[model samples]
Target: MTTYPKQALLLALAAATVAAGLTATAAPAVARPAATAVPRLDWKPCATPGGPAAQECAVLPVPLDYDDPDGRQIHVAVSRVLSDRPAARRGTLAVIPGGPGGSGVQRLAQKGAALQRELAGAYDLVAFDPRGVGASTTARCGLAPEDRYLTSLRSWPGPDGEITDNTARSRRTAEACARNGGPELRSFTTANQVRDLDRLREALGERRLSAWGTSYGAYVAAQYAQKFPRRTDRWVLDSTGDPDPQRVARGWLANMSRGADERFPDFAAWAAHPDRDRDGLRLAARPEEVEPLVVALAARLDREPRPSTTPGVPLTGNGLRQAVQNALYGDTAFPGLARLVTTAQDPAGTPALPPELAQPLRDEDAAVMIGVICNDAAWPHASADAYRSAVRKDRARYPLTAGMPVNVLPCSFWKTAPEDAPTRITDRGPSNILMVQSRRDPATPLFGALEMREALGGRARMVTVEQGGHGLYLGNGNACGDRAVTDFLTTGRRPTEDTHCAN
Candidate 1:
């Protein structure tokens, strides 16, 4: 499988809306002081292919550390597609992107039209590039190019699930970030993102901001809601993961094993179907046999790696395992994975590595992925023996992930502790939250979403889409799921209780 920062990739695999109306959610009467003087955004025409022609972009300046507002500052790139009908505009709707590395401004470009169409002219669609991401102030770890490969960044265990090399890499990566990341890298925590968001709200001069957050973005949005509950209007969390304050990003990583297990059946059925025969991609005669076939093939590759389309970067057993894990994120990736498996199974055929796996990630991308996860909370300083034991057990329980989900990461060797404890999500907020999740998301999973729901207590309602993918709303094309979320965003109405949508 392709490697990126494990947490970011986990979030990327796991990855809308708003509405308007009447009074929006009433903000608390308390007068809250702005962290700093909110600057005027000089919005200018910024158009991209398929993006709104009227989309405007600007930069919002925010402190690198909220505690030290007068210290240093950085700019967050912001974009907005203003409501076409200003007379009907309700408020600003923020589209939070997944991945510690996901570019929110780009996401606005990608999804702005659909959002506008879905909600009519009710709200201004807006998003931003968080610090260390695209079009914003960026920081790099000065990592060697070789160390930036997805496989290199993700803690994929040794061929036998041993974690010796993984431990060494973790130490090396942590040291590199310490050496070159500077304070900006240290500032890339979820808390800072929330602070940046609040600054965005203040800059927009909106008393309340509605938002749609997906994957890791859901966690950020949840934190925003927790810290500044009354500042939110309609909130939509898509494909949420567990927000256990204790585990934080670590829990999200570990949950992927279950996610993979939950989603594999869907792929197995597809790969075994007769349709695959026409494409010469069928792996087995039956769905039951697909797992074993893949398992056996992975083991064979482990023993003797196969040459790949990328010279000198042959496909390893772990590479195949990563491919399988990534392919489970969406149905569209099924064919590429099926073909890769078939090619790897061929003794004389060369397998083509997925594009993500074929090249190393950029230094900034790697830095942002590692920065957010590590900065969010402290990872356990488990001994090498502990990591080995965990990997062995996880590999046995979740072979599709091959222990990667539970494997050690650079966070394990992070020198700095989290500045603040992970924000505990709670029911103390407004009851305006709507969560839409896929039943078999290979990154977030249904069980994790349940944990988030339980965390929110009575403050939220969930729409369980009976699907086998990562994202919902405007993704996967599930009419039932889409309608439920759109209805909530556009009309401020939610299911009275938890509901399920048919596939």
Candidate 2:
């Protein structure tokens, strides 16, 4: 799950999704990584153009395969910014990015200054690019350009819930990965990511690390805490997913429909507001009319796709649905999504496709994204008729998603089973985990977050924000929610009980 300041290609929830999800129950016993020497980090000044001015970068060597500790090593790019007040500094805080594709170094650059300001001198901020991400060891499947497009990555079904095309594409994509990805690609699982995190901790010489993991990163952090309970301090899981081992990412995807339904009211209210009339962004005169209006417009688009700014790519019903799904991640996205609908609604007007839809993703970017989720858990190999029936039922039940959530994905035909079984997130860890979630998250819905909370038991205390969005802390949450996270990170004071923060 990816949501942020709405940058191009930062559309993991839409353009590209991730490899795994957290589950509430147990899976087969996990094969822990054998003890290995922590590689040294030779830090040097490496700041991006618009990124943190004082950020330093380093490369950490982690085993390509966790089972063979002395085997091949993959480089994980790491970045760090020391706490300004060394005297008051407590320890290190890792800023874990959301997607299996999200770069932690980039996330640190995006929020480091703000985080540093909020954190004061509590800890040194650190982040990293997991294996196969930016500035790290990478792999690819040499997928066709068409397969890398946001529309294709999401595997959105036909307007009428048809999956024949989706099934064929998913099968072909899986075959390409198996044929070209080689063994290295298969190693890109959530389990390895968690192991890589512990190795990062060892390189830092930190006995216990604090972390703020958002969206998919939250799941990574949770797994880390699960595997190495004694190694975490004041952990915060932001916008977490359900930890059901059987479903994992599939469960996370399926839950998005509920998330969309829960969150759409906020959008409807905004789009129906009288103020929006001034900008010609109003969709309907009333909140109730907004949903129906969107549904009807989508149905109309299904009959005839409209030309878009991008040559050769028309704005279809699924494209509109994707845009809507993406816009739900943040309120700032509302205007653009509204304008898209407005332009498409005009018979003579041409709409502009979002970045993911406008162009195809890079081969490596697409490979890792498809690799992680598909490698995390086993998907149903049920007959095609069964999948079709499920999609039809889903489309009817959750019109906003049009069955995309439950629809087929590249994982449905994936060649590899999870190398390591999924981890069951239990309450066995320290009670330092603080989960802050949106009441209406479009990606990780509140219901899923509740399951995560239940899985963590007393180990986690959640702060539910009275808002609608994917990310919570520092991005979409209100002051109350932000303060909760900041306070937990700095002073280690968690709420006595689960509490709600008013928007």
Top model number, TM-score: 2
Per-residue lDDT of model 1, residues 1-503, tens digit only: 01112124433441111001111122112223334666678788888889888888887877877788876767778889999989878899999887877777767777888888988899999998778776677788888877776676777787879788778888999999999999999999899899889888989999999999878888889999999999999999988989999998899889988888989999999999999888898888999999988888888888899989898888988788878877777788899999999888878888999866776767777888889899899889988888888899999998877888888889988989899888899889899999999898888889999999998989999999887887677876388888988888888999999999988
lDDT of each: 0.81, 0.82
Predicted candidate 2 versus true structure: per-residue lDDT over 292-343, tens digit per residue: 8888888888899998999999998888988898899898889988999889
Task: For residue 340, give model 2's deviation from the true position in Å.
Answer: 0.5
At residue 322, what lDDT does model 1 achieve?
76
- Clashes (N, CA, C under 3 Å) per candidate: 4, 9
TM-score of every candidate: 0.93, 0.94
lDDT of 2 at 222: 93
Clashing pairs in 1: 1-319, 1-322, 1-323, 3-150
